[model samples]
Target chain A: MIKITEKPIDVQKVIDTASSLNAGAVNVFIGTVRSKAHGKNVVWLEYESYESMTVAEIRKIIDEASHRWPLLGWAVSHRIGTLKPGEVSVVVAVSSPHRKESFEACQYIIDEVKTKAQIWKKKYLKTGRNGFQQAHK
Target chain B: MKLKIKTFGITRDILGGRLVEIEISQPTVSLLRSELTRRYPDLENLNSLFVAVNNKYADESEELSSTDEIALIPPVSGG
Candidate 1:
């Protein structure tokens, strides 16, 4: 499953979708909005995406990871719109026959999503200024 | 050809709007970048900028048609 939503991410749903009886291990990664950025206090974050492209890019990342690892199932979801600190922004779940592959694939998915997805985040600072910056830089 | 470009993130602030239309003699990603930077000098200050042609990250050599969906993608910050 792959989704981009404005609603709070249903973390359990992703895990459920990725869990399979055939898989011996499942790994999940959750990314959240933080209250500080580059030493500045952040009030909130606003996420936006080139909706269609973002989804396509995420699907591509998943496909690439699946080819690199032995996977049984996977699910990824990203949230958009204004979110407060500590709010979930993204979730990636991967199930594999072994724990090693699941962990590696899960990390690979998030890394690819951060760099390749057509999604952006705007930081609202407490100093009365707000700006957008590239993630994972 | 006239092309409508969608802007996001800092590009939106620099362009002062979400969308802008420009007339270009040639329809290509590189020409569009030249036209955009020519119009908005501040855009050059961005660390990086990418152009998407019809929802896919496009290369400079990619040719664009008038009806194609074009967007300016600044450095992404998605998690």
Candidate 2:
């Protein structure tokens, strides 16, 4: 499963979707907005993506990961629009018969998304000293 | 050849729009990256950069085509 959405990530839904009878292990990684960036206190985050293409790319990632690892299931979801501090922005889930594949798939999703996926985020930060910056591209 | 580059996140805002035009003969990914860095020196200094051609992560040396979906993606450490 894969999606680029405006709704908050449903962590339980993702986990449920990835679980199967034969699978003994499941792993998930959640990314959320933080209140700081490069030493400034962040007020929020702005996330966006090229909607259609992003979705396609994410699905491709899942397809490849599942094939390469032979995992029972995998899902990735990323949130768009504005998010306040401590909001879940992205979630990834993977399940397999053992812990190793689950863990590897989870890490694979996060690291690959960082470099490969089209999703982008801007940190809206306000510093302790009252300074500000929008960290982006 | 000319190519359209779409930027987002920090790069889009810094470039002040989502797309920009670049003209090159047989453009390569490396040329695009250097051009962007040259045009926005500050962005060059600000974040780690990656180039993608047609929505896939690409090597800077990869050959480019005008029809390709090109993007300049920076490090996204945010939530």
Candidate 3:
């Protein structure tokens, strides 16, 4: 399953979608907004996405991961719009026949999503200023 | 031809709107970038900018049509 929505991510739903009867291992990764960034207190974050492009790019990443690893199922859920601190923004889950593949695939999915998906975020700080930065340096 | 380009994130901030229309003598992605930078110098300073045509990252050599959907993609910050 692949989804992008304005609503908060349902982590449990993503995990359930990734669980397969034939798989012995499942891994889930969650991403949340931090309270502080660059030494500033974060008040909230506004997320934007090229919705159709984001879904397509995430699907491509999952397809690549599945080819590189043995996988039974996978799910990706990403949230958009305004979110407060500690709010969930994204979820990635994968299931495989073994623990190693599940872990590796799950990590790869999230990493790629950060860079490849057509999504952007702006941080509103307590000082009445906003900052735009990448998820990773 | 006049093309309406969709802007997002900082691009929208710089362009001052979600969509901007421009007339270009050449119909290529690179030329579009040149024309935009010529008009909006702030866009030229962005660390990285990508021109997406029809929801895919378009190369400089790609041809553009007036009807194609185009967007400005700055460095993404999603996880």
Give per-model TM-scores: 0.92, 0.76, 0.93
Query: Between candidates 1 and 2, which one is better according to DockQ?
Result: 1
Model 3, A1-137: lDDT tens digits are 98888987878999999999999999999999999987778778889899989989988998899999999999999898999999999999999999999999999999999988999998876654455443322
Query: Candidate 2 A-chain TM?
Result: 0.91
Clash list (residue pairs), candidate 2 = A32-B79, A35-A42, A136-B10, A137-B10, A137-B11
Which candidate number maximizes DockQ?
A: 1
* Candidate order, TM-score descending: 3, 1, 2
Indicate whether candidate 1 or candidate 3 has the larger DockQ.
Answer: 1
lDDT (10s digit) by residue, model 1, range A76-106: 9999999999999999999999999999999
- Candidates' lDDT values, in order? 0.90, 0.79, 0.89
Candidate 1's DockQ: 0.69
Q: How close is candidate 1 to the true structure, as a TM-score?
A: 0.92
Clashing pairs in 1: none
Candidate 3: residue A37 lDDT (0-100) = 85
Task: Provide the clash count, candidate 1.
Answer: 0
List where candidate 2 sits over 4 angstroms from the true fold: A50-70, A128-131, B23-34, B46-48, B57-67
In candidate 3 the C-alpha lDDT for residue A116 amounts to: 86
